[model samples]
Target: MAASPTPSVSRAPLGTVPPTWLGKRPLPETSDGFGVRKPTPPELRVRRFTLPDTVAMLPGTGFASAVVTPAPARVIARSTWRPGCPVKATDLSWIRLTFRGFDGARHTGELLVNRTVVDDMVSAFHDLWDQRFPIEEMRVTRRDELDAPPTGDGNNTSAFVCRPTVGSSTFSQHAYGLAVDVNEFQNPYTKGDLLLPELAGSYLDRSWVRPGMLTPAAIGAFAKVGWEWGGNWHSLQDRHHFSRDNR
Candidate 1:
C-alpha cells in the first residue's frame, strides 16, 4: 500500500503556537477601582453613673430614675429618670441582659447596667416601636413570639439557621444582649432559600425594606434598644433584623 502514504501532518510556524505555560489570571487594577467603604462618625457617647443594685432584678429590669442618654425621639422624653434595674454605684460588675427576638426566645449576655444606660435603652425602644409600627391596626410582636435560633454556624441553636456573619458581634452591644430580630420572616438572609411570597407585604421588599434597604426609622427602634441593623452593611443587608454593636 505504498507504505500507507506516511500519514503525516504539518506543523504551524513555531511562533504561531501559544506558550504552554501562559497564565489566565486577570491583571490587577490601577489606582482607582471604586465603591470603598467610608467610615461614619459614631453617635453614641458614654457617661458613667451609679445604679442601685436593688433595681436590677425587676422583670426585664424596668426603671425609675436612671441617668440615661436622652432619647433622640420624644415618645420617652423623660428617660433620664431611674432605671428599672439600676446598678448600685458600689457594684461595677456587668449585668446580664436578655436580647429578645421577634419570638419570645432570648439569648443571655451581659452589659454595664447603671440606671442611666437601661433607661436610655428602654426609652429608645419605646419611641422606635411607635415610629416603626405607626399604623394603629399593626401590632409589634413580643420578642418571645419569633423563636428562631441565634446565628447558626456550627453551634446548636433552636433558630432556623445560624447566621453568625449577620449576627451580633462577640464584642457587640448584643454581647450585652441589647438587641433582637422581630418577625424573622421579614428579615431573610442570603443563605438558604428565599422567603415565602405571602410575607412580602409586611416584611419583605426589595427597596425600602430589602436586605440593605432598611430605613433609619426601623434601625432607630432597635438601636434605641441597643440593637444595630445588619442592613447598614454596604455589601449586604438584612431588612427585618436588629442586633447590638455586631455582637
Candidate 2:
C-alpha cells in the first residue's frame, strides 16, 4: 500500500494550549512510575507572565544549507552571553540554516554554537534537513528570557543559553555553546515530578508520534557527530536535549 501523506500542522502562537490538553487532568506520574508533584510557589509565580513568540519565519531560499560565521558582538549582546560566561564571544559561531517546518514548507533558522563544534552541528542539521525533519522554530535565546514567565508551551530550537544545569549551580553545556535543544515542546525535560515545559505532559506518550518529535533517525543524525541525546539518560528523560558531553 502507498504511504499516507504527512498531515499539515498549523503553527500556533506561543503560550496557546492545544485543545487536546485543555481540561485534561494533571499527569499523576511520569512514565517511570515516579509520582508527579505540583510546581513550587516560585515556579507558579514565574508561570504568571507570558511572552509572545517573535521569531521571524522566513522562507527557505534554496536547498538545505548552513553558513557559519563569527558571532557578532552586537548580536551576542542581546543573547544570554555576559562578560563572565564560560565561553568567550569570539569563540562562538553564528549559524544560519534552512529547515523543513511542520507546515511542510521550508524555513530559515539560526543558532549560536561553539566554534569548535561548528562543523559537527552543521553536518547533523544538514542531515536532518535532508531527512525532512520538521522543527517548529529556531532562534537565539535572549538573556531576559531567562526570567520570563513559563509559557509551558515553547518549542524553540536553541543553543547556547548561559544558564546552569537545572537544580545545580554548575554551568550547563549550553552555557558553553556546546549543547542544543530541539523542538522542546515535542520532547520535554522530565525528571521525577518535574517537566520543563509544564504543560508538555502529553508528549510523554511518544507512541502517538507527531511531526517535529525526535525519532531514532533524528537521534542518529546527532549521534553520528558525537553528540549525545538526553532521552537515553536513565535518571531523567530530557527528550529535547543534545550535548557533546552527554550532560
Candidate 3:
C-alpha cells in the first residue's frame, strides 16, 4: 500500500476574537426600561380551534407534529419533598402538595400553602392521569423545589429546560404558571444545536414507541385551559411538555 500523507494541524489562531455583541438589555430595573410598553400576552398555538382530541392537529401541520395538551389529569399524585427528603417544617404551612407518585397519593397534613395553587391545578389533573401510569409504579416530581433544571447534569430523572428565545425574548408562560415539564425521562428537550437528553433509559428508547402512540388523552385536559404541549412541535418532539405560549 502507498504511504498516505497525514493531515497537518494549523497551530495559528484565527482572526481577532470579538466579544459576543448583540443588542441585549437586562430586565428593567424599574418598569420604564420597557418603553411606552404594553406587554402583549402571548398567543397560544392551541387556541386556533377547539382541540378535538388529546393530541390536537397543529394549526400549520407538517411532520412529527401535533400539539400535546397539558395532561392536568396526568398529575394523579402529589406531596412535598425537600432536596433529600428531609423534614424542613414540622410547622406545616411550608409543606406543598407535590406529585408524590402518579398513583393518586396526596401529601396533605402539611401546610406548604404555595402548593395550594399547584394543588388546585393538580387536582384538576388527577382525574386525567389515572390510567396513564397505572397504580403499580407511578412517578413523583415537584418543580418549584427542583434544582434549577438541566439538572441536565444527568442526575435528575425528571426535568426539562427550554431556554429563553435568544436574549430577553418575552415573558414565557412558565413564568406565569401556564407551562410544565413533566417526567424528564420520557422526553428530551432541545434548543438550537443542543439535545440535552434526560438520562433515563425509557425516555431515550424509541423501540417502545410507535408513531401516534403518545398518551394523548392526558394532554387534552391541559389544552382545555390553553396550555400547549411541546411534544407536538414539528422539529423536536418533547412528549412530557405543555405550555401556553409566552406569558
Q: Write the per-residue lDDT of candidate 1 for residues 1-247, one digit (tens) a residue.
A: 4566767899753422323321221223223221121221121011011112222332543221223232222212212112322222222223333332222222232233333346544454355434433110111122332232221111001111112233232332222223344333334343223222111223333444432223566567656566566656655544444554453
Alpha-carbon local distance difference test for all models? 0.31, 0.76, 0.33
For model 1, state the Cα shift of residue 200 in Å. 7.0
**CA shift of 157, model 3, Å:** 9.9
Of the pair 1 and 3, which is ahead by lDDT? Answer: 3
Best by TM-score: 2
Segments in model 2 whose C-alpha atoms lie over 4 Å from true places: 1-61, 66-68
Worst lDDT window (10 residues) for model 2? 43-52
Local error of candidate 3 at 91, Å? 24
Candidate 2 C-alpha lDDT tens digits along 39-139: 42322221212122344544446545454567887779888999899999988998877777765566777799999998898899889988988776778
Model 2 TM-score, 2 decimals = 0.77
Candidate with maximal lDDT: 2
Order of models, best lDDT first:
2, 3, 1
Compose the digit string of candidate 3's lDDT tens values, residues 191-221: 4433433223233454555212235665676
Instruction: Give the Å shift of residue 25 in candidate 1.
Output: 47
